[model samples]
Target: MGRRRSAVLTVLIALVAIYSLVPLAWLVVNATKTQEGLLSSFGLWFDDGRFALFDNVRQTLTYDDGVFVRWLGNTLLYVVAGAGGATLLATLGGYGLAKFDFPGKRAVFAVVIGAVAVPGTALAVPTFLMFSRMGLTNTPWSVIIPSLVSPFGLYLMWTFSQQAVPDEMLEAARIDGAGEFHTFFRVSAPLLGPGIVTVLLFTVVATWNNYFLPLIMLKDPQWYPLTIGLNSWNDQAQTVGGQAVFNLVITGSLLTILPLLAAFLLLQRYWQSGLAAGSVKE
Candidate 1:
């Protein structure tokens, strides 16, 4: 009976694996083929003739007046500025709320929770109007400012702070003559490493994938990120008949995913450690 059940589970897992990998397999196979080969030959297999993969990359970079590179740069800037700033703000605000007792504290926490429940898309129009009033639209700030205010990130930090940080440690630091800010920096922040990393990872992915906000805010193509750039390529593909942009689009998609993969792999240790830390402590 045990062997029979194991065999059945193995088959089920195999089917699930194939379902997940089939699309990725198709993408890799299609990306290697030329435009002619893509349309002419079986898509899942390689063709007799080969076009240089380097050439495709070159064309993708140089096409549309080399705007793709600009988009890549813009994406990096947004992730670093928006995500980095949001993570910092969330950490500070969360730590304060968790440790300090002051007037309107409950009100502040309630407001932050309410903000987290609100969809970012619902606020986009209002944000645009406010930015427009300040004459900040069509600029990097329009995107960066919105990305910096992440209520979910704040909530994550608050939860982490409440559980991960100990009151005894804070009291010890206070008795040692460390001021509140100094104690937080020296004592609390070091222990909150996992939470900080968690917030950073979440912020990075959110800023990287953001589209509608940038679309409504940015009119200039030069400021476009990879999401918008690839979309434009897809839109123009129909008009440019016989063009190899389909392959370029696939290649661009692969390139866009590479950085995200690298980031997650590099930060996986911290993420695991954070989860373990939280569970073991509380």
Candidate 2:
């Protein structure tokens, strides 16, 4: 019976994997075709004598006076600032809520958890109006400031720190003449490594893929991130006086995903180690 169940689960997982990989496989093959070839050929594979991967990549980077590179830079800036800020704030706030006691603490937790239930899309219009009134709608702060708040991240850290960080360790630090700030920075912070990295990865992916906030916040193409920039290329393909850059869009999308894929692959070991270490304490 167990063997039969295992076989069924394996089949289900394989089907799920194929379902996810099909679109990615389509993207890769289509990226190698010309705009003309894309419209003409089978989508899953390259047609005979139609491999144009190099040309597509060259045009993707060089199109519109190297605008793609500028957009890449803009995306990097936003991801670093927004994700880094979000992780730091979540870490500090979560740690504080976990380790420290204050008046109305339960109420604070309740409010934060309630905020998590609120969909981000629902707040977009009101947030836009608020930023508009403050003359910040089109500025970088408009995206960065909002990105810094992560209710889910706070909840994750608050829960993790309770288990990972012990009261006795904090008391020992206090006995060693460490200030509250110093103890948190020096002692509790290191122990929360797994939770911090977990929060960082979540924020990084969230910030990197963020589209709606930046779309509404930015007006200038010069400030557009990869998401909007690639979409603009797609829109241009259907517009008058614009070159058909569908192939370039495909290649550019492939390029956009590379950084994120690399981030996950490189940090994967840290994630495993952090989780393992968190489970074992001195």
Candidate 3:
């Protein structure tokens, strides 16, 4: 009976894995085809005698005077500044909330919780109006400023800090005459490695994949991120008499996901550790 059940579970797991990986496999297979090959060949299989992955990549990078490269740079800028800033602020805010006592602390906690519950889509229009009034719309500041606030990241760090850090160690540092900043940096920071990486990965992925906010905020193609830029290419095919660069779009998408895949691969350990935190008593 046990063996039968185990085999059934293994089959289910294999099915789930295939379900998740099939789209990625399709994307990989199609990215290697040319414009003509893509329309002519099967999506899940490579085109015979016409592997144009490098050619598609070259055209993707050089198309429209290298707009794809510009969009890539813009994405990097948003991730570094917007996501990086969000992680830093979340780390500090969460640490303070977890470690310190202050007036209105309960109120702050309530606000953070409320913010986390609110969906970003609900705030998009209001944020757009606010930025428009400030003359910040259509500029990178609009996107960067909004991206800096990650309620979920703050909450994750807050929860992680409470368990990962001990009050006794902080007291010992204080008794040894270490200032708050010094103690946090030297003591608490080390213990927060996994949590920090987790939050960073969250923020980076959020900013990298952000579409709605940037869509409503930016109008200039020069300032567009890869998501919007790739979307524009896709939309071109939908328009009447518009030039379709579906091959470039497919190749660009593959390129777009490579960095994120690399990030997850490199930070897998830290992210797993972060998730497992507080699962066991110390």
Quick one: best lDDT, which candidate? 3
CA lDDT, candidate 3, residue 84? 97
Error of 3 at 219 (Å): 0.6
Number of the candidate with higher lDDT, 1 or 3? 3
Which residue runs of candidate 3 sit more than 4 Å off their true CA positions?
A: 1-9, 240-244, 270-282
**What is candidate 2's lDDT per residue for 65-104, written digit by digit as tens?**
9999999998888888888998998999999999999999
Please estimate how well model 1 matches the true structure, expressed as its whole-model Cα lDDT.
Answer: 0.87
Total clashing pairs in model 1: 0
Q: What is candidate 1's lDDT per residue for 4-68, written digit by digit as tens? A: 99999999999999998887777777777788887887867776789546666787788778888
Alpha-carbon lDDT, every model: 0.87, 0.89, 0.93
RMSD (Å) of each candidate, 1 decimal: 2.9, 1.5, 2.4
Order of models, best lDDT first: 3, 2, 1
lDDT of 3 at 279: 54
Query: Where is model 1 poorest over a 10-residue stretch in terms of lDDT?
Result: 235-244
Report lDDT (Cα) of residue 14, candidate 2.
Answer: 100
Cα TM-score per model: 0.89, 0.95, 0.93
